[model samples]
Target chain A: MITIKDLRKTYDGFEALKGVSFSIREGEFYGLLGPNGAGKTTTISIMSSILKPDSGEVLLNGKNIYTHSDESKRIMGVVPQEIALYNELTAYENLTFWGGLYAVTPSELKARIDEVLKLFGLYERRNDKVTAYSGGMKRRINIAAALLHRPRILFMDEPTVGIDPQSRNLIFEVIEKLHNEGMTIVYTTHYMEEAERFCDRIGIIDNGQIIAEGTLDELKKNSHARETVVVNFNNLNDALLQKIHSFGSDFKQVDNMIYYYTNNLQTELSKIISQCNDAGGEIHNIEIRKVNLETVFLDLTGKQLRD
Target chain B: MIKLALKDLRLFVKDKRSMLITFAIPIALITLFALAFGGAGNSGKDAKISLQLSDLDHTEASASAIQIFDSLKNVNVLKVTLEQAQEKIKNGDEACVLIIQKGFSDSLTAGKELPLELQYDEAQEMQVGLLQQSLIPTVAMLPFNIGNAKAVMRNRFDNMVKGSDDSVHTQIHKESDGLFDALAMGVMQGSGTADIGAGFFGGDIKMTKLVAAKKDNTLGLVQAVAGTAVMMLLFSVVGIGVGLLDEKQEGTLKRLLYTPMNPINILLGKMLSANVISIFQLIIMFLFAAIAFGLDIYSHLTGLIITILATAYACSAFGVVLASFAKSRQQVQGLSTLIILVMSAIGGSMMPIFFMPSFMQKMAVLSVNYWSIQGFYDVFWRNLPATGGTFLSRIFVLILIGTLLNSLAVMMFKKNILKLS
Candidate 1:
């Protein structure tokens, strides 16, 4: 188990983290979800042992990490947002070098590299320079480089940002595999669906504090059981959108589709239908589904997941 | 530690800029210098004299004087009837004019001495007094040698020219090495070589053929080239440091910091790779210099290697220091330009240190260039034993400084990384 007690981080008199505390248990896929500048990066950085906390005790298995940093750092693998592989080197070469830094012998590095490359489907492109790789390819290499030493704990920050759907799926698949294989992962991102689907427990942080932290099902059950409905309407312009918005405050139109969130789904549906009929708009198929993690997040934070 | 160092080496090789600066630039500069300056062959150096011979006495005695002047190497013997010589003397072209004033062979046989005038262009002549003093013995020793050789004539030629202490009337033909020969002699002998005919222009003394050049010219040539290499090689350190700055800007350095590796080890790996790159650059330069300039770098290679190693360490340390100080690649580029330009200029990279001002020399001592250049001079010009040792010690001191600077840089870098995170 990893525990952070009263963690504080400041930069030149501006508080980034103000006495926040959290703990991640063993064999748990924990998500640290926050917007930009919410101290997500700082929190993770401190946890990864790259940056020291101002006033905190990071205890790993009852041992204070600050007092025994060398041992603590050795157990964690960090997959940074930025692709950190050396561009001038081949992916395999970068892996070889990073592994060596971790005290892995050449023969060991070679064998492990082969395994990881095959796992990521990067074995065919192993000899290509990182600079010559696609954005997705580089991202895979970055994650693979981190996994070379097989750390007991894995920390990934925005690991799937800006990649294609195929790449995104591949990354999520790998994360799933790692979690099932008993690697305790501390993942941070702004993506709610990814957190909803993947994280065993979620920590929704805002303004340097974790406002909500629990399993997805538990958080949803604890909150009002509301279903977010997708009404994909057609050609409903601005004047019509304003008239329709009067039906519910939690409603936004994107292209032809209107997404609305409400706890009183039966009443909210009647209001939407009446507004559509009065506006002389044809109502499309109303797909009814259970409230997802995004709706749960919207109810809690009052913001969209994509935003 | 060794494994980590090797890992750093792998990372270093992954960087193209590091390889380019340390290997490419030094060898290029060395080759450029070898071509621009003397490689193995000094270009067409021979005897040259600026003289004005005015024959006032056009009789047999003066004619013989003119004949000796004509026989000298590259000597422009002007046969002006004493009138034209006067105009040239004021023009500052001629250093000295040999004047045969109304002297005949009859006066020498009758034992009556006549004055021989040597008019000099005082403005053009830097060492007129020395030249005048030298002319005395040369003019008198001429006919004495002829007289001594003709023993059948049974004449004592002991009393050659009778004149005052400062001024002597000529009684013999002359022999003298002009200014170019003197300068060449100064340069050659000043370098401390054991050779005879290097300055010999026969009067009565024969050319001493006993001495031979001990230090091979090829090895000396290579040593000179090494000086140029040392000057340009310092810039390579800037390249390595800049690589660090680039990593920082790109956020890779921050990522690396997240690794379990020691921050100290990280700095160490970089510095070690930088040193290796510098050494490799110098080696390539020497190898090419040997092939192109016929410079025998193989002879004093151990000495050269030490100097190279020391220089590399200094540069690596300097680069790390620069990287820590720099916040961006732009900052690194701007700062590297300032550092490399200043060091190269003060350290005598563009020219020889001897040509640099004494104050500049004082400043240069603070640079790796000064020690490197001095070591090169010892190897190339003097070819003296322990020149390499002297260079090696200075280089070791530089390496020590480099190590200290690198440590400081690592500390600074750690702080910077934390801030960035």
Candidate 2:
């Protein structure tokens, strides 16, 4: 288990992490969800022993990460957002080099390399230079390198940001398999659905602070954000838009569609239907969404999860 | 299209290291080499070839022969005893020794030549070869001693005619005496008039030029030092190119810190590799120098090793400092090329420091190339003993440079990499 207490970091007088605190269980999947510059990376950097916080204590297992940095880093793996790899080297060579840094025995390293390459489906391209690999393949190899040491806890920062759907799905499968095999993973991503799908518990970070943390259901119970009632009108003319606006300022109109958020969607839906009917526009379709992570993020920060 | 070409040209020029290497280094090298060698090519006018003369023949003819040599532009005739001449050649003080045998003049006049010995240290191959070539034309001038012989013959014929009675032989001898006088006067007076037989009359004089073993010689040491020092700079640059710049740009350098290894160890490991490679470079250069230039590097083995290690340390330190300042491999290449070229030019590696301007010579101390070259020069060129204070001073300065610059580079890297982050 890894624990972070009152993590604070200031960079050039700008606070990147402000008194942020969190913990990861031994075999849990924790997702940190935030937009850009929301301290997700800063928090992960500190947690993975890559960067130090100004005033914080990060304990890996039972040892403080800073005081026992080498021991802490030994059991932790970090897959950076960027592909930190030697392009001139083959995939096997890259894995061997990183493994050597971890002081893996030669025989064990060879076997582990073969195992990891097969796992990542890059065994066939083991002899090819990393520069020859595709973007997703390169990312897979990058993750494979971090796992060479078989770290107890893996810190993956936006591992699937910009890749094809096929590659992304492969990565998701690998993460799920690793989590299933009891590898404690601290996954950071701004993609709402990935967090909702993968994370056993989620932390919503914004403006260098974690504003809320819980499971999907628990967060929904705590958030004041209502279910969204999206209405598709046959005619979303100015008359229908103005009549819908009269219900509340929370209702938004987009071509032939109107969206309204309310604590009670049933009551608000009736009022919206009456207003649209009065404006001479018939409602074609409607969607009532309960409070999701994105809704909670919007409700707390008045911004999109990816904003 | 022309505007696009102009934009590309601007971008190329904006890469300051590349621009400096392309335009500045070559131009500076050319200018400096021209300045250094231009005067060296005309060195014949400034310094004469030193030849020690041991004239065992005490005759007037031998003195005249010596005088003839003194008048020549190529040879500086130093009159020493045979023992002194041998010592001078052994010590490499003189290029060669010329020993005129006891009957050198008599044998020349009698047309029975004796051996004229030319002694030289064989290790001074280039200098000895040049001096031997000059000796041919100078020695060929010996047949002109016939002028002195003719004067002696003419005097004898005059005395014979004065003492004899008026016999048939006396009358014939008297008649021939006028012809003899005319011929004798012609050989003596016209000898100075026509310069046709000027340089090559000493061929009939049998001479043996022997290679003498040198007792304490440091010939070709300067060339060895100069060549080895320049090669060390190249190795340092290559080391930096492959090690620091490549790893940093590849992100492997930063990633190495993620391991259990300390950052200082990583820096030291890179430095150690560079230093070792540079030492090997110096060794290879010196080995070739010893083979080709006939340099006796092994004569002062301890000094050579110390100098090599010191030079490698200093050059490798310079490489580390240069790499620390650069942001990318391209920058390292361009900047190192420019700096190395400039250092080699101002230092004694590209040319002898003496040949450079006084200001450049003074500024040469700022370059590590100068220190290394000067260290080698001190031990080899100046023939200072390897164990002396001067030799120790050179090594000390190099060590100081290595220590200071390496520390500064490490400090700067730490500040920029960790503190800035």
Winner by DockQ: 1
Error of 2 at A96 (Å): 1.8
In angstroms, the error of model 1 at B412 is: 2.6
The C-alpha stretches of model 1 lying farther than 4 A from their native spots are A103-108, A223-261, A272-290, B1-224, B387-393
Per-residue lDDT tens digits for candidate 2, residues A1-307, read 8888999999999999889998889999999988789999889878867677889889887789888988877888888777878898999999998888886889999999999899888898899999999999988988888888888888898888788887788889889999999999999987888999999999888888989999988888998878887788776777667766665648655466666778777677787667767777888998887788888887777677777
Give the share of true interchain contacts found in each model.
Answer: 0.66, 0.42
lDDT of 1: 0.68
Docking band of candidate 1: acceptable
DockQ of each: 0.47, 0.36
User: A189 in model 2: Cα distance from truth in Å?
Assistant: 2.0
lDDT for residue B176 in candidate 1, whole number 0-100: 24
Which 10 consecutive positions of candidate 2 chain B have the poorest summed lDDT? B193-202
Model 1 TM-score (B-chain only) = 0.51
